[model samples]
Target: MRDIMGMMGKVKEMQAKMEKMQEEIAALEVEGKSGGGLVTVVMTGKGELKSVKIDPALFKDDDVEILEDLLVAAHKDAKDKVEAVAAEKTKAMTAGLPIPPGFKLPF
Candidate 1:
């Protein structure tokens, strides 16, 4: 049927758009910092950690636990930012879709 063909075409178009969006998200980066900017982490929108930075002042033998905590916090902050970016991109991609409430996309 003509209607079915048209619907299929739209679905294909949406799939292509989603693929492009995912590529863009994969190329995006976000940065997060903690401990008054003493610790920082960079991550991609796909949640891959790109890098981490630490202030040289934190380099000492007595504060290993504190340094570890700061690193954890910075990594968490970066992950949160990455998730936010992915969610925003997904919202834009699925803006008009009829997906049910509380239905999360399997990314």
Candidate 2:
């Protein structure tokens, strides 16, 4: 009974920490670039698209397909960065927890 209660307390604490982490992530902004910096994407840590930029030279070609590809690449870069940051933060948050080695958090 005591162990169960203690586990419940830990779960509540983890929930609170996750909430705080989400807020922190939402406030962060990350930038990703592709095509040698010709195309750039800005996104929040929560993966929300904020803005996009394209170099004037890229527009000269007026190649819609190429532009689409670059945009996709840039978005992927930003998303990868967001995931990396989230993983790092989660690791820090759960540093001292007793979770099993192969267990994954629902976050």
Candidate 3:
């Protein structure tokens, strides 16, 4: 009985922590650059694209394909960063729990 109560308490505590962690993740922002800094992407942890920046030099009429490629690369980089940060936060939040290896939290 005591263990059950304790476990419930922990569950509630974890729930509260998760709520706060989610808020923190939602507010997180990261930047990614590509093409030797010719393009950059800014994205939120929730994977929403906030903005993009491309160097004026990349605005060539003949190099539209290159610019498009750089934009894609930059977006991918930012997405990876966002995932990394989210994983890190999830790990920290679940520290000391009995979660199994490779078990992902539902963000």
Each model's lDDT: 0.87, 0.89, 0.91
Off by over 4 Å in 1: none
lDDT by residue for model 1 (1-107), tens? 99999999999998888888888888889898999999999988787888999999998667899998998999899888877887888888888889887677776
TM-score of each: 0.89, 0.85, 0.94
| Candidate 3 local lDDT, 1-107, one digit each (tens) | 99999999999999999999898888989999999999999999888999999899876677888998999999999999888888899999898888999999887
How well is each residue in 1-107 modelled by candidate 2, as lDDT tens digits?
99999999988988999999988988889999999998999999878999999998987877999999999999999989988888788889989878788676775
| Separate clash counts for every candidate | 0, 0, 0
Q: Candidate 3: which stretches are off by over 4 Å? A: none
- Superior by lDDT: candidate 2 or candidate 3: 3
Residue pairs in steric clash, candidate 2? none
lDDT of 1 at 9: 99
User: What TM-score, to 2 decimals, does candidate 3 have?
Assistant: 0.94
Q: Which sequence of candidate numbers ranks them by lDDT, best first? A: 3, 2, 1
Q: What is the lDDT of residue 87 in candidate 3?
A: 87
Q: How large is the C-alpha RMSD of every model relative to the true structure?
A: 1.4, 1.9, 1.1
